[model samples]
Target: MSFTVYNFTNNDDVKILHQMGQFQVLQWDRDLSLAPWTAQQAWFASQMDVRRRQLIANLDGRTGVTLQAGAMQWTAGQIQATTGVKGAGDLLGKMVRGAVSQDSMIKPEYTGVGMLVCEPTWQHLLLVDVAQWGGSIVLNDGLFLACDSTLQHALERRSNLSSAVAGNEGLFNLRLNGQGTLVLESPCPQTEVLYIDLQNDEVKIDGNYALAWTAGLQFSVERSGKSLIGSAMGGEGLVNVYRGTGRIMMAPMQAATSYNTLASQPTS
Candidate 1:
């Protein structure tokens, strides 16, 4: 019930918004604002610095806090908006990609484990800064996590976390390298996340929404080879496979799940 919100004082400084999902009073504005410039009190001012009334203002109103530019919100998997906030510079109608950039200084990139966020639709909030490379989060749904955390050295059970792969699925992984901020969850964010560079060639993915593929591609399971009384006597059968050249981010409606939903997300 809280995707975004930050109201400080009656005005002056803090105020971030985002909740129009199902809509009600509807709120907007994510253009950031600031204070301290000798405190005068101006409320609606976007990227326009003609030195406003210059006492000491530079580009971006000399930087204090002010947001409302454009081009932020992008949908490929799940995005449910319905904006309409008539307040400070209004129109927060889009831009849902918030989670970092209060100035971004995030650090810490090890002690990780297999990742996990396979369901709850994996939600969406990205502000990447993997902190100098070290990869492994392969999940187009089917998350695997084993890294990234801070301040909680408190005691035991810490074998690094994320380890689920015993039967069937095989290599289940989540092995990040350091520096972090990964909140991935895409049943199908408009598909297209490929990486097919093979030497064995043979790809097939009707569902599983691959997040990273290309190890030469070679997985099996294209069943229904005619048996079962000749295709259950006939529904035409013939469909149960995934050959491999290693690259699959399919879901034009693979049907694993998709109707484009929203209820604050997170149900898995």
Candidate 2:
């Protein structure tokens, strides 16, 4: 019981930008009707000529792919999905973690020969190799998109209570461990991101600009300067501090500011 959607088609606009093992990253270059055809909509589109309207990921046969719940656009061939739960104990732990961290309780796992296409989004898609990330990576809330099935996820809590309260971030962050490729929804393109590698060193950020970091790094919220009074005099309050040896990905612009800019735009 099957049917064809299109009789003839040419994938001239869809170009594969990267391929890692069984994963292929395809970029869609087309004008999409993201909003109704109106003067303001046309103006916005003209002003913001976002060429990379969508990103499609192609999975090879016999491989497994896990994506953010509801991120899948369509699939084909012999593909089967599972709850990605090992047992009731794992289920309960994931449920508790999801409740606290604001992540999906159940992430669907797809296997077999098929093609999984994600919904078109303006957000930049980034493919991160976990091995290069020192085997473990801790992502701030809501950056997850998709990843290979080989990865394992857990929750990492802040070492100190003050870090959670003063840093303006959640106490628990989703930590992905193991060796595989991870897909992330970036607030900006990778070119706009700044990578800082530290060796037994430390860097303090004024705000929550750090997107992801190596799990080996110790993160805390502390005063900008050595002393509290000095911190105040330096015109800085609480700051996000990362110490030890690791790498950090920081965006020049704040994520909240990017979202606010998008929110002000007209949508259909």
Candidate 3:
């Protein structure tokens, strides 16, 4: 089995497939009188953004969701769409693994840009480079980082720069200042993740829903007391608080399992 990649510039001549088991690309790019690109070339070009705009599963209608690693070989029974935006990746019929996939290779430049977006209930492992981009995680209940060998060595030696920051929000966020990838599992995924940046300001959330934010941001948890009782019965729950200037990613209130169930069904 073999694969060939071709661009739609139409510069290459159209090659005919003579043999049976041979696979070749037939690129058609020039248009007799169209805008610029041929219809097929334009269509293919439009689909190029699929790489950049990668999103989580949409649990609404039919979808074409990309899966992380380990989850590559699941049946349709194991997956579903995860967005309100129709026609995004919704695991439908049979399941084929591909979302760049977990354990996929990483380039050095994506730092502070790569995001791991999964459904609330998904239990699959995600592969991310801890040194370069690190892992930007958010969970309502708990979060952990499984660093790669390179990162682990630095962590064990206490020689890591970001790890030596003492007991602060930076410690809680677990920055992989060294090199390696982290595999994280999150609990309570269906919650809203709001990344907020105040003007040297602050923000608060309930429970432990805060995920990773910028290192410059200060970290701590505080309580809202009954002395402010008027709103105590308002179901506001204790707000997991933060201050300073940076971003905060928060998860939603629903559990991952329930959200997954809802996602697998079709809309009425």
Each candidate's lDDT (Cα)?
Answer: 0.27, 0.75, 0.33
Residue lDDT tens for model 3, 44-144: 64353110111222122222223333222212222332321223332320121112112222111111111223232223223334333333322222233
RMSD (CA, Å), candidate 2 to true, equals 3.2
Model 2 ranges off by over 4 Å: 1-10, 32-55, 227-229, 256-260, 263-268
Off by over 4 Å in 3: 1-124, 127-142, 152-176, 187-194, 231-233, 253-268
> Which TM-score value belongs to model 1?
0.23
Give the per-residue lDDT of model 2 (tens digit) for 27-65.
Answer: 555445455645465555445544343334455654588
Candidate 3 at 151: error in angstroms? Answer: 2.4
Cα shift from native, residue 22, model 2 (Å): 2.9
Q: Model 2 shows how many backbone clashes?
A: 0
After aligning candidate 3 to the native by TM-score, how far in Å is the CA of 81 from where it should be?
37
TM-score ranking from best candidate downward: 2, 3, 1
- Flag the better candidate by lDDT, 1 or 3: 3
